[model samples]
Target: MKSLKNHISLIIALFTVLASVQIYVAVDRTIAAYETRLKDDYSVIVVSNKAFVPSEFKSMSSMIERSEPISTAQVLDRLKGEMSQKNLDLLRLTLPKFYRIYLNRYPSPKEINNLQRLLQRNPAIERVEGFAQTHDTIYKLMLLFKNVVQVFSIAIAAVTSLLILKEMRLWQFQHAERMSIMALFGAPVWLRSAVLFRLAIVDAIIATIILCLAFYVIDYYGFLITQLKAVGISVQLFNFVNDSLRSLGIALGISVALTFMIVIFPNEED
Candidate 1:
């Protein structure tokens, strides 16, 4: 019963580490999807004295994905009631051309400033509006979110790693007498450590399986998807096949590495 309890504790520790890693992956991907959606909805407005084709804006900066000219008809409609035909025609001639420029992706504040400068450098452009205040707020919020997740993941990984090491150390102490007897019989180091390695490998596998199933059920049920959709962001919660394999590799690798370290470092009495 004690052995079973130890095994369960070790498995839970490994699962915690793996789950933290997978959550980081999911959050990273979701943020990327959110950025894509933001890029589609966000745009800059440029007022130019001369009309420009969409292709012309592309050359201004690689960040500029596309450009759309705002029709003059809407401006003319607003002035129609306030002016005669001759005055309206003159007003139209005086008004600068307006365009909405889209970016390929959401950019950092520095990139936004750079793009604004690049647009303003054009002699034909009278004004460029990049919505700096709103963009900065959103950008800062996204960065804060990502950093918080990263710090949280690192903290969890660090604590869980120590727990894992402690668990393996206990396992080593439990088997110390048998290991010592094997050493006295001139058994090879690998032969002496075989049991420890087997135990680590099996527990790692079990932990990986549990973690994979938990993610699969979460993904299959659309629990995360529903929440993301509520906020206008759509992203897959996890990739079942690839993430499962990755989690397995990480769990087994950490387990075997820790076990090997314990095997190599003998106790002071030994």
Candidate 2:
């Protein structure tokens, strides 16, 4: 029962670390997905005194993914009822050309300003609207969310590492007599510590398996999917193969490192 308790404690500690890592990964992916959606929906409007080819603006800024001329049909339709046909025809002839510009990705505030300035350098261009104020607010909010998640994950991992170390020390104490006897017989450190390595590696594998299964169940039930959809974003919560391998690596690394630390710094009794 004592051995079982030690194993369980170590497993739980490793599980906590792995869980925190996976949570951080999911949040990062979700934020990236949301940012992509924002980029797809955002655009800049440019007004010009004369018609211009969309390709011509691409040379000004490589950020320009593409551009399309904005039709004046809706404005013209609204004015048709208020103006005479001759007046409407005259209005169409005098209207400025407008183009909607799309970017390869969401731009930072400085990039937006630079792009605007480049566009305005053309004497024919009258107005450039990139909605800098609104974009800055959304960008800052996203950055804050990402930073918060990162800090929280690091805190959890740090705390769990200490817990894992404490548990490993307990394991070392339990086997101290055997390790001491082996040391007196001139057994190498690795040979004396084989049992600790075996126990830690076993618990690490068990913790990794448990973590992967829990995430699998969560993904299967659509809980993560439903929550993301509620926020108007879609993210894949688990990639079983890749995530499993990563979690296993993290679990083993933490367990082995802590166990080695205990072995290298033997207690006075040992």
Candidate 3:
């Protein structure tokens, strides 16, 4: 680790390997969870849980008038029955208050026109409208995140490699200018690419390990936080060490890759 550029390169390599893994896991988990929630919402729609404004009826002294709050269950049951008779489609249901989404046509567009008719005729019916959701927004955001992590990991690996290369080159030149000697020996240019590939594979392996640990830590912290919240406790300083180490590892790997490239490939014409 103390060795000049080589050690520096090694550190960076380790980081790239770890950071890639971490990103992979995070993205995977986030997307998976998001989809799961969406599915849950679609299958189960709850009626509005909004309590009636009690104060508005404050002047009504009659006990019966005061007690008759709007029935959330009644509204949902009526809506559901209407939809059934009309053969309408519902996309999802949400919340204690306002969490029901109706689809004009579901399962696909072919059935939508017919569904719409059913909804329009119902007495409890509100005007039905078709909706187009923005898939591109979600796609763009996910892609942006992926690119950022990729760049971070690559940069760390490259910088590390560059530093290592610089040391080796300097030593070679000082000892007896090995760069010139290699030219004389006609050492195939393939060597550079080969070395880079080796470094990449090594970095990938290290990154995978780091990623596994990252998920583990995230799981631990996430679980603890969830538990604390359930018990009605609040503690902030939640996670520092694990996150820092992960970042450090990524930065170091990128540096190594940069150093490796610079050292392996010389700009000077021999």
TM per model? 0.95, 0.94, 0.38
Q: When superposed on Cα atoms, how far off is each prediction in RMSD?
A: 1.5, 1.7, 14.9
Q: Which portions of model 1 miss their true places by more than 4 Å?
A: none
Tell how far residue 93 is off in model 2, in angstroms: 2.0
Give a tens-digit lDDT track for model 3, residues 32-145: 444333333331122233433434223322211222332356665667755673443342233244223322112223333444454345443344442313433553465677
Ten-residue region with minimum lDDT total, candidate 1: 131-140
- Put down candidate 1 lDDT per residue, 134-183, tens digits, no spaces: 75686578778888988998999889988988898898889988988998
Against the true structure, candidate 1 reaches a TM-score of 0.95
Can you write out model 2's per-residue Cα lDDT over 137-185, one digit (the tens) per residue? 8768978888898898899999999998888888788888898899899
Between the candidate structures 2 and 3, which one is better when assessed by TM-score?
2
How well does model 1 score by local distance difference test? 0.89
In candidate 1, the residue pairs with backbone N, CA or C atoms under 3 Å apart (3 or more residues apart, or in different chains) clash, namely none
CA lDDT scores, all candidates in order:
0.89, 0.90, 0.45
Which 10 successive residues of model 2 have the least lDDT summed? Answer: 131-140
Q: Which pairs of residues collide in model 2?
A: none
Ranking by TM-score: 1, 2, 3
Assess the local accuracy of residue 242 in candidate 2 as a C-alpha lDDT between 0 and 100: 96
